[model samples]
Target: MLRDRDNVFCFTANNLDNSLSRLTFNSCTASSIPSSTLQTPPPITYTQPGLYNVYFVSDEGLPTMQVDCKQIRVLPQPIIEINNDTLICQRDTILLVANGPNLYSALWSPVHNTIPPFDTTSIRVHPQEDYRYNVHLEFTQGGGCAYDTSVLIRVSKVFADAGPDRFVADGAYTILGGPRMSMGQEYSYVWTPPTYLSSIVKPNPTSRPLDVMAYYVTVTNDSTGCFHSDSVWVRTECTEIHLPNAFNPVSDVAVNRNFGLLNNNVVKLEYFKIFNRWGQVVFETTDTGKKWDGTQNNIELPPDNYVWIIDGYCVNGKRIKKQGTVLLTR
Candidate 1:
């Protein structure tokens, strides 16, 4: 017999039953029943992986059993999980794993659209830029889906290389500029001669001219590839030395032929000397332009070659010493 106490039912059957009976209850309503028939509702199942409250009730007249209510949970979908949120210069690989069972597909997305080579579960990824990455896992069971993590990656920027420096001439002189100066960085420089120059040496060229003039300059570099140059031009004037072949020294009544002095009369005769082939002083005189008369101590001398040494002053306040060979025709 089964009796209804209020909303609960009571049943006293003589045989044990194995069939499961489905129970219905108002989620917000509460009812009292004997604890004998409903000691506790068999563990309840949930539709999703979250907490849910379950109500238990017995036959309305069953006063011998008491019922209790509790909560249950059903696990959600699968999710892809990553171990780290960042990578460094040395260690750049990212490890990934699935957080749920029955995962059929996995996908990853970068906010910046920087595609990574590895996009599946248990992926090893190395990102080259700063961005956000997300992992999406799709389960094989009934369209279940999950996301484990989103991470930000920072990639170091490689710096650009710069070239070398310039040159100047005569270590003491200033440089007008053959080649312009360059920044001190990491780069190679190849310089040809300037349009004005016709030299072979490149960036560190030697003997290059700044203009079409007779200027010469050399360009070079330091041990570490730094550039420098030196330039120079012929700065001295041309000079010449004029000499006479012979001088007359016969004191004549009509023609007192005399070599005179250096350029006419600016210098006075100091001393005159003559040397033989053996470098001996053979003849000397203080009378300006006095000829040897081809004589040695009143004896007629032979016509042999002799050397002459002349000492005089220049117009520029400089003294000059000249030595040469002269022949006595007499």
Candidate 2:
């Protein structure tokens, strides 16, 4: 059965016994059926449609009669084509490729509910939460049956712990830890130098120097909703500076200036010589806070016990020389 209008081709063959209607029924011969035996043959037009095989010959100088076979099958119109969809994180495997040409299986609809029964076309969905995926394909042509189309897969959220943030300053105290999640997911921190000092015990931390701190940390992905955060700012200072045993080198804002706590970026004084224990030379200066009133050479020395030779520059630029002994109290 075939029907078309315009280029005209209409066929309906039931039982036409003409025996061998003197050959020449062309279907354009490249062998796709219809070859020889003409009575009234001239009607063929097919743009595209299935199964077709028709060849008949009963005599044409002998060897032109090879039975008579006829089979023209063309009834195809069941389309369902889909390819390319991806979401593979932590792997639940969603790879479905459908091509149309006479299919016979595939049905998957997941919004969360699948363990072992969805009738495959390639579906492995074990999404315990957050989901969207649909599929339906069942095609059979010859008995006429068709259904195919499905697209929806967006499962985004994959974070157990996403890196970088660490702080440690152990002088007045400050400690923090990070980038943690591998099956040891148990974290809770609500800290901002609160609790009067600071305490974070899920990764261990403690800090309080004078408490000039602003810190934030929130990490919670216990089962899977994904969470990660970090923040840091700790500036606490009281770092060593205590020197004032006795400074009365004749007060001028009370002796010398640079008795202590004068870090001109880690103070640098090279050779601040001063002697006087009968070794002469007193009240020298390397500009490291030059001060020595019980002088000599400028004359004023008599209460002796001063043999100082201090040279300096410390902290990562190291250079220090010492030969101390000082007490010229007059």
Which consecutive 10 residues in model 1 have the weakest lDDT in total? Answer: 234-243
Candidate 2 scores a C-alpha RMSD against the true structure in Å of: 15.9
lDDT of 2 by residue, 1-330 (tens): 232321223232224443444333346433332543345445554446656555444543444345455565555456767645544434355555565777788777753645556676665564534465667665676654546466555543433332233332213354554444333544444444454244653444555443345666565545554455556666533323222333344556643422332222235667666666777666666665445555566666555466666666644465656565656544
Evaluate all candidate structures by whole-model CA lDDT and list the values in order: 0.42, 0.49
lDDT, model 2? 0.49
Give one digit per residue, the lDDT tens place, for model 1 in 291-325: 55545687654556677775644334345555677
Clash pairs, candidate 2, are 23-37, 23-38, 24-36, 24-37, 34-54, 51-73, 57-65
TM-score of structure candidate 2? 0.29
